[model samples]
Target: MSTSQTEGLLQQLLQEATVVARLSGQAIISFAWLWPIRGVLYTLLHPHVILSVSRTLFTSLLTSAIIFTVLAFFTYLPQAAFLSIFTGPLGPILALLLVGAESVFLVTFFARALFLEPALSQVFDTTLVSRGQNSLVRDGKTKYASSTKKEGIEGALVRPFQALSRDGLMKYLLSLPLNFVPVIGTVAFLFINGQRGGPGWHTRYFQLKGWDSARRKRFIESRKAEYTAFGMATMLFTFIPLVGLVFSFTNTVGAALWAADIEARENLIESPRANAPNSPKTNEGDVRAKAE
Candidate 1:
């Protein structure tokens, strides 16, 4: 392309990188409260919330470990050769490939456990209380009615696999070529993966809210910008070497915080009184009339 076009592309790439960095930084800051030990403790303490999902978590970890080990073993010779010759680009490419292999499953798996289920349970329980309903019973004799139909653990367990299917698989494949593009490619990968991964964490919330597949698609599409930011931050976190595992859990907590913020905003907007601060109040009028 022409000089101006090249310069514009460079600028665009810089801007995208900046956005990813900012979002990643914000994610770290937002989730700083739940880092390391705190996040693990939170998950462990909430047995009622996390026990059902524990099997999926263990399966994901075991599968990812096996896949990562196999990939590392198979790629060792090629990776060593590449490192000896062209250590710059090929080095990162190999790392990305290996990590991506496991991350395809692990990231979604952790997101579901750390963010979706817990957040849905918390949000739904709060919603029930707001509606004058109880999720639990104080008396041993009576059980509380279910607020929402449970979709089953199998569906949640299979989500990462669904993400690896035709449509979902294509986005990841398309992002691979970008890894060769130097600095720009890395940023592009972050943006692309973040965009793809953002909505997966929200899957549990959608299911819990009783949104069917079509409605979930529509709602996610409508909030594309918000989820893109979320996904970008998550993608950046996954790019970190060792800490990414810990951050996976934190990402879930961050996702819940994000969902709670969204619900709070929606509730504020939906409240009639919140929208009409100056409107006359019947209680005030009645008290004045009684005094007069």
Candidate 2:
């Protein structure tokens, strides 16, 4: 290529990179960052959350510790080595942290299966009530609730699932290699996962509101930055091994709080119509559909 042409290409690439970096910075600086702190404070203020989750606390930690030990034994050295290729002296320490994070992530499947899921649902509902949205389950309708086909809405605002599916875990595994490139790699890993996870928390909300896929997509697209911010904050808070256990509930509270706020604002604009809840209805098909 000619010298001028190459220079032009290089300048264009640099501009794109700068734009991406600026957007990333904005995403990280949102009110969503405070959600984790809100979660922590909410946990302390509401013993109900702690009580509900405490049933499996010992089992969850012990199980996580065991899984962490075994996985670190087999994978630590290799992971550290991979990280060291790009991180050099800091690699081992970062690898140790990542392994711990992975162990915690893996054990969530068991923890959720045994107790965490229901506890989170309870926490979400409790937070919703506290935030003045009690009508979420009452006669099944309120000005603050979605006016769509929520007749089938039940339980919490989110459907239950393990941390990530095996396929998602494999994708996460693939992303881990990004850690080889130091700070940028780690940010990429977190950002990618956070992006998906942020919105996943609201499938039930979307369905409860009776939003079709297109409307839901537009709503999410408009707030993509904030959602990613929430997700990234959630990932970081939950990445801390044993501490993740508590953060999990707090994060749910935070998301519920956010959702409540959204509904509240929308309710102001919406006419004061009410729809009753289909309290007995189940949401297997639509929930999964919206989530996908």
Model 1 worst lDDT run, 10 consecutive residues: 135-144
Q: Which candidate is the best by TM-score?
A: 2
- Estimate, for each residue in 34-101, the C-alpha lDDT of model 1 and write its tens digit: 33233344455554433445564455455445555555566546654554354564665655543553
Candidate 2: C-alpha RMSD after superposition: 10.1
What's model 2's TM-score? 0.71
Error of 1 at 275 (Å): 10
Q: Give all TM-scores, in the order shown.
A: 0.54, 0.71
In model 1, how many backbone clashes occur? 1
